[model samples]
Target: MVTALMELKSLRKAYGETLVELGSENKNIVVLDADVSSSTQTKMFAQKFPNRFFNSGIAEQDMITTAAGLASQGKIPFVSTFAMFATGRTYDQIRNSICYSKFNVKIVATHGGVTVGEDGASHQALEDIALMRNLPNMTVIVPADYNECRQAIKYAVENERPMYIRIPRINLPDIFDNSYKFTLTAKVVEKGDDISIISNGDTLIESIKAGQMLKQKGISAQIIHCPVVKPIDKNILKLISNCKNKMLFTVENHSIVGGLGSAISELITDEGLGLKLVRIGVNDQFGQSGTAEELLDYYGISAIKISEKVIYEMKTTIL
Candidate 1:
């Protein structure tokens, strides 16, 4: 059954609020922002915990390195910045300084994917997931909505390792409740006999709607939300993969190349699942300035387009 109606929420707020709560509980917790605290919502933590919040002032590399230093001192640092700056800008620092040493740091990268909208390509961190996950010690998470985002913050605080959490600039719907907990696996939101619509991040809202649309056309679509993108539950992949009839579709607000799509594709191919797969996301292209809704549709990653792709595939290939 549908868990909740699409309730729009500023995920950035959740990021900040959750940090404040965690900050109060754990004195070892410190926040670092690369001067985009307001946009990324680290400002909330800054307001609550003035002494603990450090603004790195537009220096992502310096910020990450500082976080590394803090981690080495037994401080669990939660770094916040735009996704592009957090990953693409500070990769060397993260790899050499943080991931290399397995620092206890959590990088909360907001404005990930095309959701940055009017900011265009340079601001959109489409390849962040692939980049972060490739690191040996990084735990990558892409929360689907508000509840997941809050829980992910909690998860990051409880765990001790180099972690990356990707959130959005836009307000997304609520997928889970206060009771929902995140694990390193996929959550099967809906079950079906035909196909699985595996997706993560804010794009999951569209996938759920797409599932309903597919049902109207007599498609029994299974909906799966992946909170933990890396360290994917291989058993879940095995459960839904390798079926000729139950093809797989990966939906993400990221590049079809190295993001979720590529991860699953590699899994299916390497394991010899031999299942038909289609990726719905940015088609190896840069983002353009526009509203989030417009960009999503233009890139053919919207709910309507996702369902259409499945319909077309079922007609031309499945049959």
Candidate 2:
């Protein structure tokens, strides 16, 4: 992992400031919200740059179409909304208007996966990655923490396309404390020889902790944190495929079908690797009402579960 040179902060706050920073330079940049400016923390951008911000109320579908229209006019519109509404409610708008035309519209979806707790299954978006990945010309990125989110936002602003950036609601750890640097691709955090635990988004912190625990048990576990999911880091995939470790585990906050686990599975298998692979993520089920911590534990996305999976795979395959 490249050392981050920027200060760390909350994910929401970081996103708010990033919009302002990027908006200051690019006059074409516009922020469009779907009655979630306060919840997604894009209100600050609206307040600072009133002329460039558009509040589309609760109509996610209209907001998407409006953003696409703005993009067609050479305006770089960033549509902000909850993950569920952005992907579920406005899927058609995204696929037809923005992506089909290949407009440079950025979708910044907050409250991704089970992290938007206390709001229940309705608020949580556990299938956004899976859903967004299928769209042509869509670049899916899940920032690991607040710092990475900030960097990801900066990168998106500079390199515009049909990009979907996913962020969590919880105040996660500052994995990059003014010492980590981020590329627009994958980041290899910790190295090991026993197994490789590849993950993305908020779940990466747990994967890192799992690596620490595995070290204590004398089982080397490599940790890879990839923020960009859609066009995955092919170099990292090639590296992992050639590992002496025969076991690979993927972790994610979303469902296993179309999330990071599936992304890794496709790459690993296509490379003809015989690694014993296992995926740790939310199953094909909707989450219930609970705290972020509760949902993580209930869905087996916690550090303990990751460690258990790694240990089990090692034991079962080593024989």
Candidate 3:
């Protein structure tokens, strides 16, 4: 960990900045948005390159189809909107027009999970990752902070495939520095042999705090930052499974079912690791209108909640 707490910055702003930079150099890179450009921060890209920017006027389905058309024309289309509308509302379009066709359409969805804050259940996207990962040709990614968000955006543009990148509405702390390399593989933020804490996206921030608290409580909790959910880092996971304590815990801002927890569960079970998994997430419930902090706590994704669960699990598993 760094000597001090990292500064808070918008992940969507990081996406907007990287999109502008990618657009300036590549004429074939086009952006599409469903009238939430300001909120999603894609307005920065639109202003920089008006000719290449397409506005679908609140129709997320139409945006998906439009991006698919652009992708068919050999252009890399980055579709932008809220995660709920972009995924759940336009699932059919994305699955058929984008993923089925294997087009180079990169969906950059903002306001994922309960962090949409005060928007209520209908707006929060607790199942976007599940939806995207189910598609055949879609690459699912949830960048933890600004640095990874920028790198993921750049990587999505360069790599030709249908992809979904989820970003939160609230500001996130910088986890990696300028020198840190971004890879599709899972990264171990802190190495500990006692236990493993797997996490991704904004929730990783809380998981990191949970690890620090667990450390003070005499638990050597290993922190694993899983940026890519679909193509999981199996090698790293296999290595971590044989570490000090054979306990694995996954924390996510999404629902426990069909999310990171489910993915890790399937991995351990399939590989016959015989490891126990403690999944910390929204336990199959709808989100509610509240401040981001309140929602996280209510949904059992807060730092304190995560730390408590760690202690509780350690005791039960040990006994």
Candidate 4:
């Protein structure tokens, strides 16, 4: 269990501050936004480095292509916009102008998943991960909290590659401290012998809470936080292979079909782990307008719901 009290912090706020810091450190570091700087928190970067920032005025595709052009000229372009428009609206440009050429473009898409409350399904990007992960040469990262987001952004800037970082609109509890180092590997937040619960992004906090709830019900649960969605870490495969019990559950704020759960499923099947896996997420459906809290519960990815599902699955497996 985490010994310190978790502080609530905004991922986008951390991302913006990190961008400003990086901008000051690297003269070649530039930021591009698609007319949503305030919402995506890139306005902070724009304020700090006016000359290095560009607003493309609602044109996501043009912003991506422009970033690619900048990258080709040795500038490390950090692109920002709502997740839906960032990925869904500009997939062709990202695929051709960026990923195809392996341009050094950092796409930090905000307002991901169903948590963009009251915006409904159109604004929510439940399939962004799926879209980005399938693209060649694109590195996908979904940081668990503010600290991770900061580190992930720094990593993206320092390492020149075609990368996609997803940031949610809602503030999440601090899962890692300032000393925490971000890596492209799975982290075991809580260790147990009975079952393992894998998650990332906003769903990781709930997975930790669900682990606690499961412990009270005499079900020892392990919590694994996977920040990188693509290039599934070998450490995760090793952990599952050594588990005492072969049950695994994946929870995410996005759709289960092509999100973390799907990635894990591919890993298990390809590696022949033979673990019994259950996926918990938006079950092949679109999001509706509701509070962030209400939508989490409604989609059955809340801590309470996760614990309940684990208990039920355990009982059924025994029978």
Candidate 5:
């Protein structure tokens, strides 16, 4: 079931608000940061409740371990840091310490994807969804907008399993209205029969735009903003499978290997459905130093790039 309709806000403000709201409800809720409190916007929480906040000083591995320890003692811990360092740098700790043990730790990773911009490839985490979702007990979520991110963070805090919440650094258009509801697994943003554009993360804005473009070209492109990438939304996949046209596209800000595209691919293949699918995302390559828009165009993940590819496939492929 989807949660309450929340108003859209800035990305950093979203994190700060989530921290504050969660703090008010559960005294056991603690927040840990790896010296980037300002970036994660958890420094405000630190100011409000210093006793429950810990700045681990750039040690992501140690922060993960600490969060796991706290969870073991029945505390809900939200670990904050850049996605690259939080997931990439502390994979073992997250995998073994938190997930392997089935500890309920909410790993909130900020600065996800090329949105990290001038931070370059080293700072941009293009493979975080792949990394987090591959874990056995991890609940991976990629919220579409600021409002969705806030609702997802609230939902993650209440969820029992180990979870990872991804949020980009830069804010985009507010897709959801102030009273828009959010569901955990799958939410159909729009419906169509010609083709399905299943997307998540920052690229979702472009996917919405692409859908409009397809509409003008007399092609109906349905949009599904699937925030939860893991634990496949089988029902939606079944609908896509049974559709007569059976053309599908999975778009994301990450690599095509094990992200949203791969998830959708697995969903169709597992159901023995022969769907014509195109995975639109960063191929198996690290991002370079460029603006978010430049990197997207470079990696062929922009709205125009994705629409062009989809149009080409539709025209040339004998599906």
Candidate 6:
């Protein structure tokens, strides 16, 4: 295992920097934020391209409809706000105005999942993935780290489509470098024969640590980082099918239902892969006010908890 300490970087910060760069390169690029520019870090874009940036002031639905209007004028509008408001509050506008018209609007929502910390359940967006993925013509992505987030944003800007990218509030360890290329397909981070561990977003780092812990116990885990949740990657089918033990695990920062785990489960069921899946996430419960670290451990999605769950499943299945 590589023991080097990786640099920590914030996905929101990466998004802000990348937005500024993309805005400078493309005159058609415009940004819209629903009141929380500072929190979502779209204030950076607002500062750089003041003329092109719009603040809708807490009306997420209005923000979505306005973005659609911009798209109709041939401008690529990137919208930003908290994940809870971005998806849940603006679902109707997003579905009707954006997706129905096939508008070229990108929704990059930050502070996803319980990692929003002290903000509590009302602010946390545990169901945003489920809500966004169900909408027709919507491309959903939850980037794992800083570099991936940067690349994903660039990809969204280049590709004219209705895309939703979820950014976590916390700083994560750098998982990829400058040369790393972002694609819609899932990337296999580690190869193993004993079990397959699929994850994305903040839980990805925890999954990696679990893989290391499992290795010490003689368990070879195949760790797959799946950043794109919607338009479920066809390549993942083959990767999971190739797992020797047919034991699959999906870890995510969202709910077990309608999140990455549910997506993978649906794939397995549809294909009749007959793989046993153990989803690691919030078990249909609302989050409480706590530190991100505390919430992760309490929810049993931490590295130690993930490893323990995998080991327990392996033993129980063997017996």
- Model 4 lDDT tens row, 204-300: 9999999999999988888999999997787897776555777899999999988899999999998887689999999989999999989989999
lDDT by candidate, in order shown: 0.87, 0.85, 0.89, 0.91, 0.84, 0.92
Q: What is the C-alpha RMSD of each candidate to the true structure, in Å?
A: 1.4, 2.2, 1.3, 1.2, 2.7, 1.5
Q: Give the CA lDDT, 0 to 100, for residue 186 in model 3.
A: 88
User: Clashing residue pairs in candidate 4, if any?
Assistant: none
Clashes of each: 0, 7, 0, 0, 0, 0
lDDT of 2 by residue, 67-125 (tens): 99999999999889999999999999999998899999999999898978898999889
lDDT of 6 by residue, 108-181 (tens): 99999999999999999999999999999999999988889999999998888999999999999887777778
Structural RMSD, model 5: 2.7
The weakest ten consecutive residues by lDDT in model 2 span: 1-10
Model 6 root-mean-square deviation:
1.5
Compose the digit string of candidate 5's lDDT tens values, residues 1-319: 2222444346767888888888988899999999999889999899999999999997899999999999999999999999999999999999989999999999999998876888798998988999998999888888878778788887877778899988888776677764765566576677777888888878888887888787888888878888888776777775564345768888888988999889888888887887888999888888888888888888887888878887888998896
| Deviation (Å) of 16 in candidate 2 | 0.7
How would the candidate models be sorted by lDDT, starting from the highest? 6, 4, 3, 1, 2, 5
**What clash pairs does model 1 have?**
none
Deviation (Å) of 236 in candidate 2: 2.0
| Model 6 Cα shift for residue 26 (angstroms) | 0.5
lDDT of 1 at 119: 85
Model 1 lDDT per residue over 1-319, tens place: 2467667888788888999888898999999998888888888889999999999998999999999999999999999888888999889999999999999999999999897999899998888998997899889999988888999899999999999999988898777877887788887887777888899998888998899899999998888887787877676675585334757899999988888888888887888866888998998888989999999899888999999998998888853
Candidate 5 colliding pairs: none
Give candidate 5 regions above 4 Å deviation: 1-9, 241-243
